[model samples]
Target chain A: MISPSQVEVDRDKGNFHYDTDYSFDAGIGLSEDVIRYISEVKEEDPWVLDFRLKALKTFEKKPMPTHWATEDLKNINFDVIRYYLAKGQKPSRTWDEVPDDVKNTFERLGIPEQERKFLAGVEAQFDSEAAYSRMNEELEKEGVIFVGSTEGLKEHPEIFRKWFGKVIPTSDNKFSALNSAVFSGGSFIYIPPGVKLAQPLQAYFRINAENFGQFERTLIIADEGSEVMYMEGCTAPKFETSTLHSAVVELVALKGAKIQYVTVQNWSNNVFNLVTKRALAEEEAEVRWIDCNIGSRLTMKYPGVILRGRKARGEVVSIALANDGQHQDTGAKMVHAADETSSNVVSKSISIGEGRSSYRGLVQMPGHLKGCKNNTECDALLINNNSQTDTYPAITVQGDANSVQHEASVSKVSAEQIFYMQQRGLGEAEAMSLCVNGFVNDLIREFPMEYSVELKRLIDLEMEGSVG
Target chain B: MNSLKIENLQASIEDKAILHGLSLEIPKGEVHAIMGPNGSGKSTLAKVLSGHPSYKVDGGSATLDEENILGLEPDEISRLGLFLAFQYPMEVPGVTIANFIRAARNARLPEGEKVKAVDFYKELYEHMDDLGMDRKFTARSLNDGFSGGEKKRCEILQMSMLSPKYCILDETDSGLDIDALRVVSEGVNRMRNPDRGILVITHYQRLLEYIVPDYVHVMSEGKIVRTGGKELALELEERGYDWIKQEAVA
Candidate 1:
């Protein structure tokens, strides 16, 4: 019989690390000077420096949100974390020109291979700055601007300035404030009106340094009647101490436009991943957030959407898996402000070993809105008796004509189920994997073909240690 | 020599003795029927032989073609060409019938080898049609919401797909209707070849009338008390099991 490791193992795929000598470092602390040093190193405008300085103050003024969050938040030491580190100020336009160490890291992660196969553009981020960024020439000629946020702010100020932090403002939460203060090396995309791209753009974020924080800022603006799909991936090597990854993503879908954003993050267990993502949809527009979170010590993210114009739609399809010593606290939020708006939220989670998963959601419709509808379904699967799952959904709907529905369920992979599959000649691990794949079968279909296969493989690796 | 041999098989569940030193054997090219009353340990024998986790075999040995299978895992037992049609099939939600059966078929193949999808579907459709099951049932979850007859037909479908050397039908005719029983019996009849040993456990004589076993064994309390031909089933059906119990006691 073939062991699980022989079938393209993933547990060791992201565990390797490389050493690099960074040319730029913003010291190890959070202060006004450090923020100024970052803004000056990037050679930003004076107004941008002011923005960073103000965000630093906000980050310090806000307290850690530990009331409802895990007590592990006290373990994060902001004083010792290196705020920013990069090899250079500018990203290499070609893969050949990138530094050998950074290039080799991305190569091992299969970034170049994926770019060659299906992606229209590829951005590889190392620590504090983008190392390699490229896009299709054909797309550039069609007025699609796909570049790093540094380049976007420097080149296309008129378009980037209008919606940089509009969707998720820095003052919205403590993590958002922290990300706004030290954000770097995230994708900035703008699809012009009436241009519908058939291919997706991808970005890969890698955290290479120890005792560091990687804060990325992403923004996508789909103009009127335009459509685009953007996907991002993240990974980090295991560290003895803790690391931090805080990102803020904002999406704006204009009238009659569509935008779909997908993210699959696999961080090491020593990393704390706290992110804020949201979208603003206009009349007849659609915005979808497809997110999958795996392998992290603590993750607290709730991707949301605001239906601002009449007849707008929003959706969030999420899958979160928490293994040993991990907690995945994820969900979605929807706010209906106009007439005839609709939204759907479907989330599934799996907790194995001593892992814990929680789904917290909110859906609100004011009294004046008419013909607005919302539907939410949350399901959780427990793999062991020690594993835990919880659901906390807060829904409020008013007005006689509006409608809302919510459903929640919790299931366990019973011994009988496992025995039944074993009786059919499947080994214990194979039976467990099949049962898991079956539980998330319908949701996995929503992912792209390539990612669905990888997701199944990753789950198989997670189940290897699950059988006791 | 090629047979399922049980020697003084003793078993229990939850510290309660159920099968007390019951011994039986079914050689190749023969069909055996075990008829008993409610508490006579008919189903326990099947569970014990299949190595169900709940039952503990205190003492004895069971062999499939001279290979000991008393303590092996259920999957290992199954891979050795022993198939037990469960009395109550499990409902595995969201696992489609096709994929479930394909997993079983794939497990039998050598490592790194897979069953060709086209051939698997062709054979599955043929067996499903023979059992009068709907063609669309392949996409449905494995016995998730199926009726009793449909569940029975699915069990038989799995049995036919695996094609084990030894088959044990544990009360396969309990919930089947008249028409379903006929179709199921026909399906079992088609699988009755000289290389296989079939054991049917039932509380009534109705199912045996269709399959027509070669040997009829009357079980009382846990042991087989009387061994006879197919005519013995008709005699018991005409009379009752009380005389058999009295005879065993006497």
Candidate 2:
């Protein structure tokens, strides 16, 4: 077995932090000054700075959430968070050329090795900056553009500006407003027309600084007749003082194109992971969101899809595991805006110890969108008596020809099942792990093979100390 | 010395009586078939012996090799040489058959002892082959998306791998077709040993044709009404359970 220290070093370097200052004294509130400071730091064009300023105003005007899953929003202090922190380094094109500390972090996280072995491209982000970004030469030659969002802005402004914040606008939600105001260091991917990338492009995000908010914005566009898969892995160090990670991601699948976005968020219990992700599917296009949330103090994420064209399809497969002092509130939203649109949302969550998990989803079809169909299934597993899980799914079908089905169930690991496993010679913990694994195995299998293995290992790690 | 003895065993579910004054014994090297109609406490007996928490044993004692098994936890009972193949095997979604069985096998070893993966898979494949299970089933979740026959075969496969001292199979043939029944029975037959006792519980005697129990006990209203050799199963099958109910009343 690989030593935990080795695995820690390999997995921790890029994203996991150690012993950092916890003072939230940086009173960089959501203001014009902070937005200007960020734009100045990035040395953005005048028009980009104007965009940031407008977004900052939007952030200030938006009120804290007053709707569903808003109880935890009270703890977020917008004034105390450092909007942006740059280590003063340009993004490197090669892993070896990256700075030592950042390179060591990615090395520890095994980012470079994973990129070499499995990924067609990799972008390593440290705090508020992209330390290293690379694309397979063949992919670049094939007109596939994968780069950090900042670089994409500078290099391919036309493509970047067209889809940026389009799917999820700044005023869409309070978190999206915050992300648009001070977003930094996320991937911008564009698959050219009719180009198909077999291998996934991955991005690794690491939160090393303390009392800071890492807000990154990502936009991916799969043009006509193209297909691509993008995977993201994120983690943060355990800290007593709360750290914030807010991100906004937007995806566009043009006619006859397909795109799948996969995210595995494994933040420490001290980090607050609040993200907004959505995609738009055009005629005959398909979009899929494969998301897994394993660790966090409080996480609120719902990846959604808007079916904007006839015959469009969308799907979201997600698994959320909350252990101890954690709360994972996640689900998906599907809006059928055109005729014959179809969507499926399957989400499973496991709550152990005193942790709580909730599934909140929505399926909406307008009266004019005939032949639209949606299916939503949400299941939760409680590992212990103290754990809690809840599911709230809302479906509205205004069209007579539309069909929607929703099913949800919450159950505990029965003592009989545990005893049966033990009788087969499994210990209590092993049996519980098997049950939890079985509970979410269907969704995990939907991930890429390598990611599926990592997910199982992560689940096993969380299963530790789950049973007493 | 060779039996799983239940001396006046009494059990209940939700404070209601289920198995009352039930006493039976199956000795090693023998297969005892317990036949009963629905709600006759046949399934309850299997669960109670395996320490299902829903059932509370209020009185009497059950012993494996003279060790008081009543006070022990279910897992402890299982580890102490008893195995219960559930009639409705729970679908453990993400857990593969190979890993599930391995974890069970690992539990039997001393602390810090590990099972060699290669050897474990080799053994698993061999057992799966004997059960006529496709090797792909090892990669699939335990009983998830499986047919009734597949689930029963999986239970038998687990039994074969765990190799318990005494095995209690609950309604193992309830949902199987003729072909699946034969395959599952063959898996159980191969696991029979001189040192291992088997208790088969079924509503019908059709399973006995393949498993060939050494003894057959007709249970009515939570107690063993009559005990006979293998011929009793054939007789029960020929006359049906209504006759047994009439005899119990008489």
Candidate 3:
């Protein structure tokens, strides 16, 4: 009998890190001078420079958090991380105009290809040009502004000046302070009132340097009666030395508007990813965060929403996977500030080998708010005896007229389920992959169709050799 | 040439014997039914044939045609054209029925070959239609939250799609209603051909009424003690298995 031919493996994940010579490098380490050098290099305004120095002070003054924290955070040597590095080139509008180094990434990825492919680089180029041209023209006429944060600050200060750092301030968290001190390259978007974009704006970011830090600050504001979805992807090349990725993303959904932010981050096992993401929703506005995490040595990300206006709603659906010496600590936070607000958070995690995953969450509704509701669901799937998972949720419901429902479940791959699939002709590995895929299927389905397919393939690749 | 031959099969679960010196032969082109009461090892035999990890085959020689499948993995056995319509089909959440069955079908293809999507979906839709399952069910998770009759019908839908050379329906009628039984029986009957053999395991003659057997065997205490034609099932239904046990002693 002929054995099945080897299906083409995901070479991208394996060779994801080959250090290309950088045109410019800041070397290694962080200092006040390093922060000043970065702001000066970016040619920032005095207000922004002052903002950076203040955030740097906060970063230096705040002690590393130990509460529900991983020791990996303490392992981060502030002195050894390069605060910033850029190739000294600007983003080109057309594929032909892009420099050779950056062009290599998106030569075939197409000009109007959703921004995620350019930033994420998780897979090889796959979108057709005809499909891009058909949609790019329609988006241009809708008063939707999608650009880099640098360009947004330089060109459209009217939109960026007020909303930047408003949702997540520099001192909100230690990592947010660090990011505020040296942030670069994240997307900046503005949607005018009553305008809606059909296609999601996408951006991709990856780090190739070891012992380096990538700090990206993304700000998106959807005006009243407007709707937009922004998605970004993050993947870094693997290295022996530790790398740090700290990002701060702030979003504002104005009255009667909706904004959905989706992130699929798969960093190398040696990277420490600490990110602060939060959204402020106005009256009758809505915001949603769909997060998928697959690989990292340690990741502490809790995408949160502040329901600040009446009848506002917030939702977060996330799935995290941890494998062999990896830790993924992620969850959601919803702070209800107005009456008649609603929030929902659904989180799923899978731990294989000695990998450990945790869900740390907070849901709060003050005593004065009348008729607010929140629902939280956390599910964990362990693939082996050595795998571990934990869930810590802090929910405070003060006074009356607030309802909260929380459900948490931890499960192993069912032996009966494995045997059942086997009886139908799937091998042990195939059976395991199917079960793992099934475990996160409901949440993964929430992703855009193109991404859901690649995400499943990536999950299948991780499940290989997962059988013990 | 299709024959499921088991000789002096001795199997156990956790060192405790279940099947003691059981022997059964099912040849091609006929439906053979095995009827027994609870704890008679009917399900054990099915599990052992499928090479379930829990069961230890102490002494057994089982073969599908020329190959000895006594110790092969369940997937290997399935690829070799042996299908078991489980008594309690598993619930696989988030795995669509279309993908599950497609994966199974794809397992049979040679290296690097893929099952054509059009042909696969056409065949799936045709069989699902014949089984009276909604087209939407194909996209739904496999047997997840399905009613008992729905589960039994799904088993038959799989059986019809896979079209194995030798099929052992392990209590396929246990949870099925009369309408479901008739539909499941018809789906099974549609696959009856000269090159295929079917072994139906049941506790009562109710299912046999819809899917008639050419030969009937009464298994008592883990071994087949009596063999007869179609009339034997009716007689056992009327007289009960106790008489058969007493008759065996006499």
Candidate 4:
């Protein structure tokens, strides 16, 4: 554990490569043989193999999405991506038990140190499996289960099987189907009734290999009256070839329970981040997605929620920054299935240089649901003349007497605003950062304190010398 | 000695001429006031001196203690001990007053050295108290939704925190109430020292009554038409700017 005196605000320290002795490799391409190889290495049952094969068939049948940003989506070549690579290691309760190379990689990312200081639990996923995962003694005593997905399915099948694919099925989207077919390391968290953890649990997903695909399937279930916050962070080294990160996350909050799922994705600009995340909120339950996207060549993610019971609430507070050579097409979806359910979506984006950021949202409310309210706000800021942003918010409100309001705005940073801060002793770049920070300050506050500070520093780095 | 000097300063916005061959010299330990009517280039002089990008300096030079500040960025000129309190302060949403001032102060420091947090807050609270600003103003976004008087008081608070060697208050008295004007004047009065110079530009004489200047100059056509002692402000208040324009003609 790193003491408080040794902590500094630093992350993503560039590429760190090593000569890894791979214990298992599925090589490139996806087929029945590759699926069989992954299942054989994991020693999974025949039923699990059947699930992977069925999902693989679905993934092959689903056509590429041509509705939005199809040109960027066409750049991804599934044939070239290596499906799985695991550095032989089971989950270690202690940090020292991990291998030297994996240990060095995580120490640079400050995983164990953060767990010691603030987090209730920490799970570090290297390539295909969890390298280290541990929870606090108090949380363990309170019947909180925090472990890898494979371990969860093997040990706690009764709880895991019930909510596995209930929130999001395999055929939800093309990427989700791809993830279900070859999914590997991801977090599986369970909290019993009335057990409210004081700190958040975080999983840091790191991709170290070239032309690799990281398909992490995360499932979290909050029991009745329980509350928890699960944070997911991503980073990868710079490679000449493209990398793929397609994750499927499903969350279930039982009656009177609350859950918050936050994602701070800082993948290298060479990677494609296509993810499907959704949650099911029961009676009086609340779920939120606080997402911040910074570095990615292309990202298409829209985390949604299905309000399953009366008085359930959902919210998506997100901020996306797209610098040069990046496109972030991300938003939220809210479905009002139960009466008196409420939801809100606030999305803010910044596009600088030749970058592009967009907001694509969907809100659906049926006619029978009364008193269902939803509010959606999307705001975008363009840094330079060449930058671009778009908003496609589709709202369907039926005969029900529900109130659904949507507001959006697209604006460029005015020269006057920049000059105002500049006159107060900030240089042009500093002024630009201040403006961008101001644009998304309210939503960024929704994040945890540590991540909020890091997000500001990341924006400052992106805005460095970005003027035309 | 610390000083700000401008010689034959000609500036313009777009194609129109604003400041035509303006000349002024303000030495250390003195407060100079310039009273002008609207469209007489009073605010333009402040913007040009602060290196506003929209204003083009056609000719002449502005120097802060022997260093030419015309071609430098606004921040560079500001760090060289030149401060311009804008006539209409822009509202920057989500940037708190505390952090903005801290960034400005940190920008003036040498590389790798940080301003001590304890000292910064202590000095900031003291300045806010003198300005009659609420303590909560520190956390609020700078000038966002501020009343006219609140905006001026905030600008004064910033000026006190920055402590530039040369201070320029352009039309600081335009939107102030009587009570706010007195509080703002007290805040400015507390910062007076032997090594720092102040230049106050206003269209009205009410502000001059509170913070009396060492010399009062009347600008008619971008240049100083007349100069005199403190009594000149009272004369201008009674006779109006027509006397000054006619004096230039005569």
Candidate that scores best on DockQ: 1
Cα lDDT tens digits, model 4, A281-308, are 9999999999999887999999999999
Rank candidates, TM-score, best first: 1, 4, 3, 2
Q: Between candidates 1 and 2, name the one with more favorable DockQ.
A: 1
Query: Model 2 segments beyond 4 Å from truth?
Result: A1-28, B1-27, B31-73, B86-157, B169-192, B199-250
- Kindly list the per-residue Cα lDDT of model 4 for residues B1-250, writing each as its tens digit: 3579999999888978999899988998899999988889988999899888889999998899878999788889898888888788888878899988998898888887879999999999998888878899999998989999999999888899999999999999988889989998888888788989999999998999988999998897788888999899999889988978987999
* Candidate 3 structure lDDT: 0.82
- By TM-score, is 2 or 3 better? 3
CAPRI quality of model 3: medium
lDDT of 3 by residue, A340-434 (tens): 99999999999887789999999999999999999999999988777899999999999879999999999987677788888888898898898
Give me the candidate number with maximum lDDT. Answer: 1
Which pairs, if any, clash in model 3?
A4-B111, A5-B111, A115-A202, A115-A203, A116-A202, A116-A203, A119-A204, A119-A205, A120-A204
Candidate 1, superposed: residue stretches over 4 Å from native: A1-10
Write the residue-wise lDDT of candidate 1 on B120-166 in tens digits: 99999999999999999999999899999999999999999999999
Provide the overall lDDT of each model, using Cα atoms, as 2-decimal numbers. Answer: 0.90, 0.86, 0.82, 0.88
Task: Enumerate residue pairs that collide in model 4.
Answer: none
A1-468 per-residue lDDT for model 1 (tens digits): 112122222477678888899999999988888888888888888877777777888989998989877788888999999989998757888999998988999999899998898989989999989999898999999999988888898899899999998899889999999988888889999999999989899999999999999999999999999999999989999989899999999999999999999888889899999999999999999999999998889999999999999999999999999888889999999999899999999999999888899999999999999999999999999988888999999898887989999999999988877777777788878888988888889988888777888888888888886874
Q: Choose 2 or 3, whichever is better by lDDT.
A: 2
Give per-residue lDDT, candidate 3, residue A369: 96
Residue B182: error of model 4 in Å? 3.9
